[model samples]
Target: MIFDGKDLSHRALADRLPSDETHVFRECDLTEADLWGAPLAGARFESCVLDGADFRKADLDGAAFTGGGGMRIRFNDADLIDASFTDVDLSSAHFGGALLTDASFTGCRMIGAVLTGSRGTGFTLSRSNLTLANLGGCSLRGLTIEGVRFDDADLSGCDFTEATLSDCRLRGTRLLDTKFTQADLRGADLGEPDDAKLRAFAGAVITQAQAAAILAARGITVL
Candidate 1:
């Protein structure tokens, strides 16, 4: 149902929803609503404010959450296989322990979003803002992360095997135990890493200037 600018409680909205099926919630204010353990697979939520809403353990497979003003939304432990989130403002949202295999998030503002322990094999995050986001222990193998901002983000224990990170920002980002095996780092602004942080770039492709900058940070005279 189209709930443009309408504010409804979780119980009220849940009562109106059908059993174990897809539902459409457009432009609704579901802020801080608790939808824990709900069966909402293949549901579509467009331009809705779901900030601080709890979607823990919910079935959101093949779901689409596009064009929303939601920030700090919680999707902890949710099943998000093949889900698509486009143009959504999910800044500081919690996706910890979520199953995000084959999920896609394009043009989303995900600054400071937590993605720790999230399991995903295939995912695309294009033209998104992930600055200061936590991606610790996430295996992002072969993912296409174009034009994304990763400044000050925690990438500890994260793997970027064969991933394409073109035109991305990595200034002040934490790279402890991070792996970038055969990954492309062309046109990325990986601003001046120290010797310890330089160790994280062992198997990745980089520019000559980047190499010199890393060496300069290590007290080496780069002629």
Candidate 2:
């Protein structure tokens, strides 16, 4: 309940929030703050800036966004269930149509974050950067994307069933109509995928130099 230089709305910051513990918003700036439909469950936003903050339909269940850097933060249609974004930067953050079940983004940066049509399940993006992030049509089923970068990311029509993408980078990623059923792309760096983007790596579990860089970009000279 420390709103320095206050410009309160959200029912006057939920009547000076202190409904039995856990509401420490240190270094509070809350730029463009609206906090629409605010409840802010278990809130603790350390080093808080919250640039362009809206938090539409906000609940923020189990919220804890340490190391404030909430650039372009919106969280459209937000609930953010089980939220815990550590080392947060959240560059260009939006999270369109957000729910984010079991959210836990450690070491987060999230460059160019948008997350269109978002709906997460068992989320846990460790060592996250999310470069060029869009996550188009996201469902993100069975998520655990470790060491994530996702360079040039759009992830068109993302589903990622049975997901466990370790050491992820995915350069030049668009993967139109992306599903990756039974996904487990070990040590992933899936670039050079021609032949119509290798059919989105069906039943994804690529290795062997990403199948010789997707059959040498469809030249098919793999020995």
Candidate 3:
């Protein structure tokens, strides 16, 4: 029971059994609240305004949701390990089976968010604006992303082995079976791809203008 920076306003705590395990509600607003089973670990909804709230099975560890506009919030089976979502909007929000380890989404909006089967580790989203984000089966192996801007993202079965996407923008992205095998797609832009975009940087271990802009966008315009 570590209630730091307390201010629990508009509290409609439902399914209550977690009698003050860790109810911070820091910088609180807790809009349309219904905090179910709130035994939330180290819970600190900082700069809060948890709109349409219903934190099911809450045990959010190291919680710190910086800034507000938390729309339609509902973190099902939440454990949110190392939780820290800065500049939040979290549109179409839903964190199913959440236990997001080392989670820290900076400058967050998370448009069209639906993080399926989430089990993150050092999941950093810098310069964030994941347009049409779905993030299926996220198991980012060796992940260390920089300047993130996943434009039109789906990233099917994502497991970027030895991952390090510097200056990323996989345009019209939906890279199924996504694994830049031995990753480091440096200065990535994929040359304005649109022709049924199927980006599978085969045995990818990049450089050299990112393999000459993915072989000059598959047109192989004789470099």
Return the top candidate by lDDT: 1
Count: clashes, candidate 2: 0
TM-score of 3: 0.34
The digit string of per-residue lDDT tens for model 1 on 83-160 reads: 999999999999888999989889999999999878767567899999999999888888778899998999999989
Candidate 3 Cα misplacement greater than 4 A, ranges: 1-11, 20-33, 40-51, 54-58, 61-71, 74-79, 82-91, 94-99, 102-111, 114-120, 123-131, 134-161, 164-169, 173-213, 218-223
Instruction: Summarize candidate 3's per-residue lDDT along 158-220 as a digit string, tens digits.
Output: 887878777768777787777778787766675464443435666767667656665677778
Off by over 4 Å in 2: 3-22, 27-40, 48-60, 68-81, 88-101, 106-121, 129-141, 144-161, 164-181, 184-203, 211-222
Output the better candidate (2/3) by lDDT. 2
What lDDT score goes with residue 93 in model 3?
Answer: 76
Better of 1 and 2 by lDDT: 1
Candidate 1 worst ten-residue window by lDDT: 8-17
lDDT of 3: 0.70
Task: List the global CA lDDT of all models.
Answer: 0.84, 0.78, 0.70
**Model 2, residue pairs in steric clash:** none
Tens digits of per-residue lDDT for model 2, 1-223: 5555443322335445555556667777777777776778778788777777887777888888888766788888788989899988999899887788888889889899997777756467888898898988777777777888888889888888878888888888887988888888867777767544578778777778778767777678878
